[model samples]
Structures are given as C-alpha cells and as structure tokens.
Target: MSSTAPDQPSPARTPQARAGHALADAVREVEHHVAAAGWDAPVRVFALVRTQAALAAEPGLADQLTPDVLAAARADDWHLTSVEQEGLPAAEDLEQLLAALSWPDAVDGVAVTVERVVLPPEAEEALPADPAEALEQLLTHPQRQDVRLAVGVLRTGATWCALRTRAHDADDAVAQGADLVPGLVAAVRATLD
Candidate 1:
C-alpha cells in the first residue's frame, strides 16, 4: 500500500511557512513545560529589553552566547524595550503596536514576554485560599482572579517561554530558569536584525 494519498498535495514551504512552523515548535516547547507545570496561571505580558547596565548586570547570558550580542548592543547603543501588559494583544493590535514601538537600530531582537501558570505536582488548582477575601476582592476588581502557575510566552512565533508562578503556594523552581527558550529568543534577534 502507498503511504501517500495520490489526490493530496503537500503544503508549500515558504519563509513565512517556515517561520510559522518554527513558531509551532516554539509553542509546543512552551506547552510541554506548561503541561508539566500547572495550567491555572494568569496570562501576563512583559517587554524584553537589554541595556548596557542590564547586560553588565547579567553577564551570565553574555558569557553563554558566542560573538557576544551584548557587546554589539554596547557598541551600537541598542536595547530591546519591554512593556508589561495583562493578557495578550490581538494579532491586529499586536502588529500595530509593534509598528509603533521604538526599537534601537542595533538591538538583538524584539520579543514579547508572557507568563504561564503552573501548580505543584500534588497541589490542586487553588481557589481563593479565603473565600470571603476572594469574594471581596472579586467585588472590587473588574474580573475574578487567582492563578497559581504562569508561563511567559513572548510574541515571537519562534519562541516559547515558561516561568513558574510568583504567586504564593507555588514552587520557586517553576518561577525560575528560562534558558530553555533561547532558540526562539535567538531567532527573534535574527529576525529583528
């Protein structure tokens, strides 16, 4: 039996298609992390930025990459700007917003910051630890909220990011270590360049 369907056509492989596929990989990577973590975290947005001080302060990454991207930043006076937003922007809004952004000419790349929610291995999805307090908070707030695990996913389709929740009753490990998503980060830099 033939494995291929005679009537079916293969998908076109274009640069955008390639980028989209890369993005799918990136999302999958982050999703794998999210599945392991908990999925109850609130979505949070962050802006990626690099500055002379930021690079100097965080030399570990500087040491990690060959050719020293930060050195270029320092030489050319460029940095990514990070703006924190709740949830995510719609695609149209994002394109418009990105267009409006003022990026440094020589910055590595632009990436959106996002957070994924994670719960501990045994912990159940938490409710308001205190119902009355939760109720009061809900009344005061526009929407109800309580998220335990949050992973940050940048807008770069070629990227996936996961951060453990910073909320109480969550694991520090989940909230730590982001070196896993460097592939997408590098791709973002490359695209920006």
Candidate 2:
C-alpha cells in the first residue's frame, strides 16, 4: 500500500506581520474614502502622511526649526502653522493639507513606512563630525531591530491622522512626526480656506 506524505505545517504569523496587514487594510479604506470624495492631490496626501510620520518621530524639533528646513518643506507648508498654533496635529489634517498642496492631482489614498535611528547623548557630539556614522551606529544597534516607525494619514476634504512607533525603535519618529504635522496642516489649511 502506498501512502502520501503528511502535509507540512504553515509558518506562524508574528504580531508585526499582523499589524502590517491591518495597516495596509486601513490605507485601502482611506483610499476608498478619498476616491469617493474626488479630492485632488494624491502626492500631496502621501507626502503629508510621510511628513506626519517624520514629525511624530521628532516632536519639539520644529521648536528648533530654521529657515533651511522650512524652505525644504515649503511644499508641506501647513506644518509651519501647526507648529505656531500648537495644534493636536492629526494625520487626517495632513491628508487635507496634501490635497491642498497638490490641488487638481486627485489624491485617492496614501500609505508609507519609515525607519529611523535615534542618536544617543554620547553620539550627539559626533553628529557634527560625521552624522552618517552616527546614524549607522544607531541603525545597526542590536536593540533597534524590532522597532516600527510609521505614520498613517487619510483625507477626503476632511483628514484623519495616527502616529505610532515600535518600542525597540527610538522615540525619534514620534518627535519628528509631531514636529512635522503643524507645518503640514498649516500649509494645507491655507489652500482649503
């Protein structure tokens, strides 16, 4: 008698895997909403969401803002106003801002992921000498592997925003993400009004 081999077991799904899937689904939902609303500016929305994630990673960074960064982020001007107003800085607002910035582009949706390195106090001094080296050290740290740095922004004339980062990941993304929202919101709101 011939017998077939037993079936192999499937690999277990980790929490990160599950979370990523959920996030992707959420992005899809946001896309549906934007499409239905027919809002122009898809790149703006994606950029705003990315900016939100960046600011959330580095809160209070804006307080230390300079003209150079501002010029680089002129496309995301709303962040400047939000920084000035001390707004709650919603991801949705970023989406609206994106729409405003990229008017007539028709933003259907946006999803993004970012990875960052946090500089330690000891490393701060080295930043001026060789910033890239410091960043490499932080990124390669054994303790930093599991960290997740991300920001999700959804908009349909109205916007919704959420900021999150993994524990192993440095709090940099959180602060950065927070700092970026104000300028992003201000820039977008200006166009809407």
Q: What is the TM-score of each candidate against the true structure?
A: 0.26, 0.28
Q: List clash counts for every candidate, in order.
A: 22, 41
Cα lDDT computed for each candidate against the true fold? 0.41, 0.38
Candidate 2 achieves a global lDDT of 0.38
Q: Mark the 10 consecutive residues where model 1 has the least summed lDDT.
A: 145-154
What lDDT does candidate 1 reach at residue 81? Answer: 31
**Tens digit per residue, CA lDDT, model 2, 68-167:** 6545444432222121112223445444434534322222223433233454566555454576775676667654432222234334333333333345
Error of 2 at 94 (Å): 16
Candidate 1 achieves a global lDDT of 0.41
Q: How well does candidate 1 match the true structure, expressed as C-alpha RMSD?
A: 12.9
Cα error of candidate 1 at position 175, Å: 4.9
